[model samples]
Target: MVSDRRYCRWPRSSRERTCISSIGPLLQPSSDALEKQFDSWQLRITPVDYLLGVADLTGELMRMCINSVGNGDIDTPFEVSQFLRQVYDGFSFIGNTGPYEVSKKLYTLKQSLAKVENACYALKVRGSEIPKHMLADVFSVKTEMIDQEDGIS
Candidate 1:
């Protein structure tokens, strides 16, 4: 097992430190493969399936963010944002053919992720704690919007 003390070593030179800092967080395990799978699945799945898959993936992404925080890895937030954006872009490729309910839910999900991304950006810039309430609000809004849009009223 990788020890918690095992950190990626940055170069000693000041110039190298500047370059490393500018490059941002190093990618973690399986991120590239996951993105590729997400892309391939998005292309093949039906609208309903796509929405469901995205929702599932979103949940996983959130968990990853939390884990990152717990592990003192701030870079995960940026990765989450990038993953979310890719998910959104994948959905966009499906156009207007999705069920109205799914479409609306997806939109709400996107909005919630926008909030997360903004929060992460703020955290990255100012180094703050991301509010638990914000994450809760996103999930609640997503559930409410999905139900309402799906005529579950």
Candidate 2:
């Protein structure tokens, strides 16, 4: 009998597995999946690369928070807040042990985290006060504050 299930067989090569493993934790795969990946590949991810990838998560989080606010999504911001806190805690613990490259990423990660935090705070404190459409429209602004001198405008 021909089975209809997908993933009937694993990748034929470690290189293919390596490519798949490079997808990172953005999908938040379960521990079982991770175990399977490691067992299948018999490969260990590099710490610097892993840290860099983790650092990259902050940008995705910031965008998520922004979109959540724009969509009047109260729950997502809270969830993202908790996730960021966990990431921050982990970063603070090992941040100093990392290489110079990680330090650069740490700076960027901090900035992204702050932006998400502020967005969450705004949503929590002002969510009820602001109309849904107005809140959503807030994300659609084309020109950033030109007076700030950030040159985003």
Candidate 3:
């Protein structure tokens, strides 16, 4: 068996995580593809790093949902919400047993999912009442109010 110390050389720093998160969307590779690429380049990454990068992606997806809504795309928010729910469900299976970095990202992931869900809820319930052009603004204000109430900001 490989010793745990062999894995210790992989940096757990936030800078490394930020780099990993940025690269993921550009290449958009599957996990297997990423593993193969890393092997070819003689680089190492832990499972926890992969999970953290995925968690960071939820925040980007949340932004995409809001931007798509602003651009008058009514379908993207629901689609993103569904995707985020699946990711959240997957993370839920990991529970509190993950590394501290992985566990910490779960809250951010949940927050991203919540924002998408809120946008979706608004679109569904008030689509008829609100003008299409103003929908994004309404969603932003509603999200901000929720953040304030939740003591997040």
Candidate 4:
């Protein structure tokens, strides 16, 4: 009699396992499921590519946090901050050994994390003083100040 239980194999390298496991829950699908789906579509992505994509996700999440604030939703920024921090921690495992491209994105990822943290800071500090409708304006001013300080404009 054959048992119905399935034996699964995880990636051999702790790094690959960390990268896949880190991104899995944020994507709302397990890494195994994503792999199966990609396989069915004949798609392939190296671990480096996957890490790069997740790094890029930080920027999108930053935008989302800001948009949530614009809509007067005060809680999402903190949630995004928590998620971004987890992503950042996962990347820390790669450290200086990651590819040059990933290294470059790590700098960007830090910047995105900082922006979200700053937004959350502003909300926590000034939230009580500002009206709900004007919170977006406050975020815009804060972003402008940050951009100017960074010499982006």
**Taking the tens digit of each residue's C-alpha lDDT, what string does model 1 give over 1-153?**
111212232233424422111112322334468677665322222557546655555655555565455455656667667767877787677556767765665665575466457547555654654454354344345446645664656
TM-score-based ranking, best first?
Answer: 3, 4, 2, 1
Best by TM-score: 3
Regions of candidate 4 where Cα sits further than 4 Å from its true position: 1-43
- Please provide, for model 4 over 1-153, each residue's C-alpha lDDT reduced to its tens digit, 9 standing for 90 to 100: 000121222233434433222232223333577667765322244678767877776777788789889898888888779879999898888877889988888877877888888899989998899898998888878777877776777
**Cα miss at 140, model 2 (Å)?**
7.2
Candidate with the larger lDDT of 1 and 4 = 4
* lDDT by residue for model 3 (62-91), tens: 887898888898887887787789999999
lDDT for each residue of candidate 2 in 77-144, tens digit (9 for 90 to 100): 66666667778777877776778877777766666666666666667787778787687555434113
Give the 10-residue window scoring lowest on summed lDDT in candidate 4. 1-10
- Runs of candidate 2 with Cα error greater than 4 angstroms are 1-39, 137-153
lDDT of prediction 1 = 0.53
Candidate models: Cα lDDT each: 0.53, 0.59, 0.73, 0.73
Two-way TM-score contest, 2 vs 4, winner: 4
